[model samples]
Target: MGKENSSVLPVLQWLNRVVSEPHYLLHFLTFFSYFVIRCSATHILAPHLIHHLLQREIQTLLVFAVLALIKGVREETWEAFIADALFLAKICIFVLAFTMDRRLAIWYVLVFLVMHMLTQQPPFQGLGTSSKLTPLQLESLLTEGNTTRLWLVEFCASYSSGCIRSSQQFPELSITYSSKILSFGIVDLGLFPNAAEKFGISLSGCMGQLPTYILFDNATEVARFPELDFETTFFHPTVTKGLLSRHFDLDRSLLEYFNVK
Candidate 1:
């Protein structure tokens, strides 16, 4: 028994070390930024062209900063200086834009300010799409044995069809999915279980699944899932039931999509 306990200690120690490493910290920052930008773009800037441009500019700055860090290892000082200068330029441009146009600026500034404030705070650390669990949240969830809730919350918040396009532009801010028990269960069973059923796959204990499996791997295969099709299926009577029943104040475009009267 003592020998077994001693053997397990190093594994436990390694786990702790990996969890507390800097890479995890960077991952958290990346995901949080992506989540904030997505939410902001959908809610605040969807209709406005200028707001969209501003968001794109900020996103561009972030990309360069991340690239600098990745390439900086070989050319440390030069890369670091370039990254820092780009960051400072980003801030100055934002400030100048705000000062020049208060009305349009307010919308963009609010989004930028909120993200900046959130990033600076330690409590907001590691709160991202990748790991549904912040350190404290994970500890509590583990103690309570409520792993299912964690997966549900993350899926509802982070899983989006549009996120893939956005992540392509900003690789550092991409949300990664690891092959964990809870994540596999949610992706396989909860999000698109119907599709999986069609594929003759069981929901239990599946391994090495990728996100592309949730949707058909190609556009040709995608056409088969009628319910997944936004244009034709989204307006179906059965689909509109929930939206109409809840009496959501959606616009004409959205109402038309739901086939709501």
Candidate 2:
């Protein structure tokens, strides 16, 4: 009789009992804390650090917990799905933006999308206007002669011979002289002669090549000038074709430059 009674108890009864238990609350809180920690660590601490951690067993456990939470939410509500999808989409967009050259329209779209997505909430309604400038506004600005064409140049200047020669004994990477050029005219102004000066690199000639060389060197130096010529070209629709073509070539150059191994 006892065995029969246990077997006959409804599944809902077991579920209710499980939910009412104190341990269930403890487990929920623990899982919640872990999720918060992972989210904060990934966004605030170091993205690469969290990226590495996510490749471990702990990340698997966290994913499981997140899945469990989604399941517990019960209803297949639109708001829930939309919220989750947006979160995932925002992450993917930003990741792609950071990984690729910032000059791409796709990168700008990602940034705007993330900003607009966030501003769909209260107290930040004007972000929609601030995050984007309309085509008409850009056109009027261009017609008013408020724009300038600039040239950028970059070159490898010098290297330490000792660092290069000691590849077997005390191997070190050689430092090369790099420069930039910025010209308002069609041709490089050549005003900046010293490659080592603070702004020696010309934006007109070599700014487009900076990322290619930096990637070739396996370095992150180009990130220092995030708002260089790319930002200036952001509002100019006419230059889109040229910019994209140059970017494609730059991608090829990056691979070729890095093949130095």
Against the reference, the lDDT scores of all candidates come to: 0.36, 0.32
Off by more than 4 A, model 2: 1-14, 57-261
Please write out the lDDT profile of model 1 over residues 1-261, one tens digit for every residue: 999998687457534543574433433454355446555655544467546566766775686667656654532222233334434544544553453345645655565556454432111123234433342453344345434321221111122222221212111121332112222112223455554454433333222111222221111122121234445333333112122223222133234434532
Q: What is the lDDT of candidate 2?
A: 0.32
Evaluate model 1: give its lDDT. Answer: 0.36
Output the worst ten-in-a-row residue range by lDDT, candidate 1: 149-158
User: Taking the tens digit of each residue's C-alpha lDDT, what string does model 2 give over 1-261?
Assistant: 998777556344434543564432333343344445445656564666555555543544466557546743642322233334345434443343334324533544654555454433111011111112232432333244333211121222112111111111100011111111111111111322343233333333233322111111221133222234665434322112134235324334434445642
By TM-score, who's the top model here? 1
Deviation in angstroms for 65 in model 2? 11
Instruction: In angstroms, give how far residue 128 of model 1 lies from its true place.
Output: 36
Shift in Å, residue 127, candidate 1: 33
- Return the top candidate by lDDT: 1
**Root mean square deviation (Cα) for candidate 2:** 25.2
